[model samples]
Target: MSLLALTAFAAAATASVPVHSVALDHRGGTYKVDYRAAVETRARTIGMSAGTRPSTQRCIMTATVSVDRIIADGGHELHARVPGEKTFTRNLPGDCRGRAEQLTALVEDRQPAIGAHLAAAAASDRQHALAAIDAAHNLASN
Candidate 1:
């Protein structure tokens, strides 16, 4: 049906495109980093068997990581925290004036699993949409 087709098309379109965002926040003497991630899924088909029948469909995912905003805080102490983690403070090597990059790195180090989680969620949604489409197709053919 048209509804099924629309659902599949929407899922495929969303999986193919990468989202982008931009924001600016002015703050005095505070180090802040706004990180964003966009995940895209690609369907890879391996070698086909005899009679040109499709063997299997594989979902390969890629993530685009972006540092949306990085504001430098003026001080000698740097604080970094990620979701589900405790906040940690570190002393800057020389001074707190040029440690924005260091702060960002410190925070990013604890966020490597974010892309994986996003990919899994996307894959689950894609699978559900695909199942719905298949069910609809079978019903229509019968």
Candidate 2:
């Protein structure tokens, strides 16, 4: 789940009284996963003339493109060729199974880098969280 999704879930959870504490489970392993048959859509207006009414002249063009997303997990680290981007996707219109196999192979090739980057990011987040906790404790003591 994305961070925004998690934040929304947390908000909803806090709004109601829960009988038990929430636990988020994560799987730890080296793996490559691929999701295929994803669709990408883009819309744009075409043929706009100053003499013609905008609404009448406007045309919406849409195309459905098949895409596949691949991800590599190296325990705690993750690095991708596209810096600052979490996912790697490609346009592949083919059998889902075949596309997945190809995508997995691609992810496996970059697994090492992905793992390293993810680990660094996780460590940074952990450090920041600890610092925030320490700051809160010190403030409370004072």
- Using lDDT as the measure, the top candidate is 2
- Model 1 vs. true fold: TM: 0.25
Q: For every model shown, what is its TM-score relative to the native structure? A: 0.25, 0.28
Q: lDDT (CA) for every model shown?
A: 0.33, 0.34
Give per-residue CA lDDT, model 2, range 1-142, as digits (tens).
Answer: 2455334433332232111111112233333433222222222334435555543333232222222333434342222222233443334432222233333343444444445544444433443333433454477689
Name the top TM-score candidate: 2
Q: Which segments of candidate 2 are over 4 A away from where they belong?
A: 1-85, 93-97, 132-142
What's the distance in Å from true for residue 138, model 2?
Answer: 9.8
Clashes of 1: 1
lDDT of 2: 0.34
> What is the clash tally of candidate 2?
6
